[model samples]
Target: MVLFAAGALLLGAGTTSRIFALTPENREAQATGPLTAYLEGQGENGAIWLKLRNGEVLKGRFEVKVGGSFGAYGKSRGIDRPGAAYEGSGRAIQGGSPAFVDMKGPSGATVHCEVVNDDANAHGSGVCLFSNGAEYWVLY
Candidate 1:
């Protein structure tokens, strides 16, 4: 009975890991879906604000420049610090939807944000997960 229980536990763990494993295609889909929605609403220039879980505030200005690239600068706590800019190029995903964006911050941190655009209410929220395990809730 003990051996059976142990085997069951191992099998369950393996299954959980497999289920949570993120492949490249899954990663792209996860990013692209929200990114495409956010950019479509942003037009040429837009502003976004993030309130970190730790009470830090980050304000970002986004610009869709020529060649289909995007750039952003974020100010935290009303202070403009060096290395707080983000820039990336936008690409279409499998269905030709503009959803994949590869952006890196000034500190070389990768920022992953998922946003839903709500123009009518003007109260859209999203989450930004950083490479350093820091997360922020974005309000746009």
Candidate 2:
């Protein structure tokens, strides 16, 4: 089973992944550069907390749709079914679905992410773009 419910992904799930800067300047300095940010999720949906070098923490949510079906997680992604499997949050997401994440930072900043998910194991990899002309590689 998969979980894509929405409310608060930063509530604490102890699951976190490191995101590296994909920028040219940051790329050359990545080995000794800043941590860039962090990415995490529960099921097909989760939140991104961007911890940039400027000591900024931007928060955002991620949603996924399988075969272009279903809607946002917070709206109608959590389809309640009886005798279903259990994984992550309490939502079921079809495997091989495309994921899109939208998160807003302070001062009109935003972070957008695109990920390819393997719902069976609740793990995925993708890329995230920050409004400040920064890009990051995401995995969790």
TM-score of 2: 0.52
- TM-scores, each model vs. reference: 0.29, 0.52
lDDT by residue (61-96, candidate 1, tens digit) is 333222332123222221122222211111111111
Q: Which ten residues in a row have the lowest lDDT in candidate 1?
A: 1-10
The 10-residue segment with the lowest total lDDT in model 2? 1-10
Winner by lDDT: 2
lDDT of 2: 0.46
- Give the per-residue lDDT of model 2 (tens digit) for 1-140: 11122212222355544342333234433442433444465544566565555565667676666554323431122322221223234343345445566767577777665554444554444455556655454444
Off by over 4 Å in 1: 1-102
Assess the local accuracy of residue 121 in candidate 2 as a C-alpha lDDT between 0 and 100. 52
lDDT of 1: 0.27
- Model 2 misplacement above 4 A: 1-43, 69-95
Highest TM-score: which candidate?
Answer: 2
